[model samples]
Target: MTQSMFRRHFRTPGTESSSAVRPLRASAAAGPATETIASYLNKRLAEIGVRYVMAIPGDYISDWVETLDDPEVNAGLVRVHPNNEMCATYAADGFGRAGGGKTVGCVSTTYGVGALNAVQAVAGAYVEHVPLVLVNGSPSVAQFNSQRDQGVLWHHMFDGSLTDLRIYEQITRMAIRIDNPALAPDLIDAALTACITDSRPVYIEIANTLEGYAVAPVSGRAKLKKSPIPQNTLSLDEAMSMVLPILVDSKRLVVLGGVEVARFGIQDRFRQMLKVLKAPFLSSLLGKSILSEYDTPYFSGTYNGRNSQQNVQDLVNAADVILSLGVQETDFNFSGVASADFNPLQPPGLPLQGSIEVRMGAARINAGLTLQDQGELYWGDIQLEAFVGLLQEVVCEPSGPAMQSLVSQFPALAPVQAALQAANGQLPNAPFPGLSGDIWSIPKLTPEQYRDQITWDSFKSLLHHNYLTSFGNDENQDAPVLLADTGLTFYNLNNVKVPQNGFIAQLAWGAIGYSPAASYGVKLAQMALGSRRRVISVSGDGAFSQSSNAIGTIAALGLDNVVFVMANGVFAIEQFLINAQAFNPQSKTAFAPFTRVPETSLWQWVKLAEGFGGVGYEVTTNAELADVLEKIKAGPPQPAQPNGPCSGSPAPGCCTFAPDATPDVRPSTFTLVAVRNVCNDLPSNTRWKLG
Candidate 1:
């Protein structure tokens, strides 16, 4: 029987607990094996919850990859081969992100050639605080020892056998070479533990020789023990004392939710605290959709410093205490790179007024995992997980004397204001009357009228209106995830209302072409959890080309995702950065030859999609786009991911093999939609201009 009892429920975004390390696997308590390094490592992987190890196989890693498919050897963990190393790494990243960093995404590749391709994506994971375990196969121990001593160069090797590990050392939290059988268990366990505890990627190297090497398994129960995270109690108490009164007495409070809420696996607490306190909440661009915007009261749209509506900015600036959770100054989006007026703790270039001017900005208070009270001295290392939990309890459950006393002083704050409501409520002197004051609902246009009004803003406005009215607002269900690739797409990511647990992006890393492949991995994770929510990925032409092969895998597997390829024929982001004036109406004629996509690079999206075994559509008008979107939404139930062996027919045109040759379980198919091309005179965002 499967270990369904241990099927970890990594809480959906905007929800969860602190003692959270989850694994998505069909596990079982298999007894200790005969002790080959392969068996031991695979057992550990199973225990840690890696359901699939995404990789592009190479000679050195072939043996390990093969062993993974051997159920007896791997305890049900499978080896998934994606299009390329970049795609594999992205898939793994998506898998981990979907699980809220509680479950780790594992990858394996060959020594040098294959491992190098993964560097950029792995670095992205490192920067984003994503947990992943990268396993690379190396030359046999004997070959490495003899060749290195004889000064011989190998096929996929650089200076030395440990070269790849050294390179990865800079990116991963742990980088170790497990050359000997005796050291495999501890080393593997340590690496996996670090991935989860630190919420960062780890690198593990296993030589081809070690695959079958006999090793003694750990003596007793095989589960690796989690490292006990100790917190500075005195400092935690001090921080609590300092923050409570400010929070309790504040007249207008706002909870500025951020990416850390999901990364730290504290979404539940964050959402709960927001409800109990009835505070207005705003998600940063990178943090959008972690919570549902539809039913959530007091929820404003994404906050981008000065880009926000004047009233939105003022609502934040005027807050007596703005609790900026999970945001740091290091974010390029806020570090004067995207805007000069993005600082939230000390909001919008205003001078501190009145007495009691002690600002506990996260930059000053928290250092990575350690949460401090005030100055660096009080940064006695109170762990964030511990601190957030304690804070949640104190705020959400105000039964304690101190908490009750504090709660009694604060008045109940209402949620998101109703439409057409006066601009004088929680949002003082607001220009508009909605959660997000920016949404301008547009009227539906006929085919003829849409011909003249086929612009970006028009389409966005119409789409949001359609989606808001079409989908059910069930707070309990997981919503479709929107994965935005880096480009002009970033500017429009949060233009519409986000459903609960809806929204995924690598914005901080800003990797173009990530969303396409990431959709594959996200679908895999969602399938494991029995969720059939469609993954909507938005990609620019440039970024989409980077990993368009991801569509092949998605189609072949019968996965359900909608890829909206904004067929902009050039790297618009490059033009924007090289000459900002190009975006202005006065400088619309500005041209940069390098930014123009060559004819060879442009994809006939429909042909490409068809060749990859998915339905494709090209829409140039508002009417066409709207009709296609509604048709997709109203289509048949998205096929559920199969847990058992592959069964049923593959998606039509997905495969040409004999009907009974393989029953690969692909119950549904993907659709590719090509929208209006933005080659010239594209949409521009003044707020995101270089500060």
Candidate 2:
């Protein structure tokens, strides 16, 4: 196809006039003879800087897997084998997040069951704006054509139709089934570009027969390019005109950064903007760690409506003008119980006149001109970076004396600033006995300080203290931490300090067992980026059991990430709510017995971890955990290289973690620190009502 024709065919919708359609980089051109479609796909992935492809092999995709196995065709891409398709996809998502969109994550799965299993992960990626390339192997072209013509059933077919592709379409930016090998390169290139430009997952279904199909190599200049950042000068000027006047007039201004700032790779730019604006700033829950809280002077704290600290809430609520960047108005973002009149899209109410929201490709301004009509201005297709850049420029122009005078009219942000300063002091540092704060108030608790038996609160307190004492400092600034599940485990860890871009949690989706599977991918991505930070995963017993099989992947791959399982012997979050809402005074019955589980009789996670080819430790008190932490600290360092099957040997079978006659031996060591806790015990601040 001609260059112009190719560009026209693949240009993303709504970006027709965007400057993102520059000519392909010189490195993308073809080299010599034509290559097989599979080889070309791998080359394209490498060219686009994808370092790994998380995968799970199956019958339909065996041919493609073999092609990837070929040393000549594999390029520099490493194929990672997760225990299941779900873990594979989650790993890809984690990789994308950690790489900060510079390196796209890829996952390969067989058609039907394999592809279907990855749908949940893909959906989460979609919602979170994570860029991922999902490649699925389907029936051969001949088989597919025959099925289309005569309804022949394939081995993995569900409903005797191509349902896999249909299912992914809803959760991906682009979904294409390659029926013709000749168009394979073009299709893959288009999907990859979309994945990058939109920051969402894209699905590509390659027919098994097409792996070896020969096609003309793409020329060096015929590469896929990300859509240019649109200027949108007129829209930007219009929006800024409406916003700056109000901003200049306001006395109290606050900047609220959200997940989009991180997703769009604009953390640095956002930080610069905050510095230039010189306003107190806070982050939404998802936006935490977009910038380091410890370093930013004006960073008040995180805000979640009623759930926020009284000081944080007062600071945000009292702002006369608020500039929110890339914030999504989710139920959880607003603490799930914000006032009915609370409109995150606009200012909370009245005198707080000017509110500005800059989204991925949209901008909104509320001038608060009238009670009935607040003179809200909306503009679409405006790049968030460009809008913010222009806004910063306009706000910081040479004619700033008037703006400075207006800002000086307001009282110093002392109340909010003092509160933040106090909170900052409470933040744990290298020293063990850091001053206590609202949530982390207890002085570094030791196992010896507690009674013989460990309760949920004591265990949680000990874990929090250990994490702070171990990694919460400038020296360990880049340590990676993962929080699995959405109950007390997440709640406790959320309050802990994490390095910038080092925390991973499915908080928005609240998916169970996400952390265990996702931690594997996070560690892989960390290694790919040449980081030596030890990965730490925290999970409740219920959530850990859901994806505990992933421990095998860790052991088989020789990854040394640490996982802490809070063995609470129940779905504590569910039971907490049930007890609160369904208590029967007469019958003295709380809820069904199913809410609880036998502690020792249930799956022994410590033994399970041992079976998975990793070391296991059961800690019942703070002292025991302290000993475990010291051992971990003194343990052998992670290998400078990956020693898993992907390095050389054949990949092991699934369920390698299961018990066997002869115990499986592995090179790597993973530790399962099982903290025993009481079933009904919960943190004091945990509320049980739904919003």
lDDT of 2 by residue, 432-482 (tens): 111123422434554467655566556556655665445545444455455
- TM-score, every prediction: 0.80, 0.80
For candidate 2, what is the TM-score? 0.80
- RMSD to native for every prediction? 10.5, 10.2
Across 354-432, the per-residue lDDT of candidate 1 in tens digits comes to: 1121111222222221235333323445555666666666654445554443334432211111211232221222222
Clashes of each: 7, 9
Report how far off residue 673 is in candidate 1 (Å): 1.3
Best by lDDT: 2
Candidate 1 lDDT at 222 equals 57
**How does residue 667 of candidate 2 score in lDDT?**
69
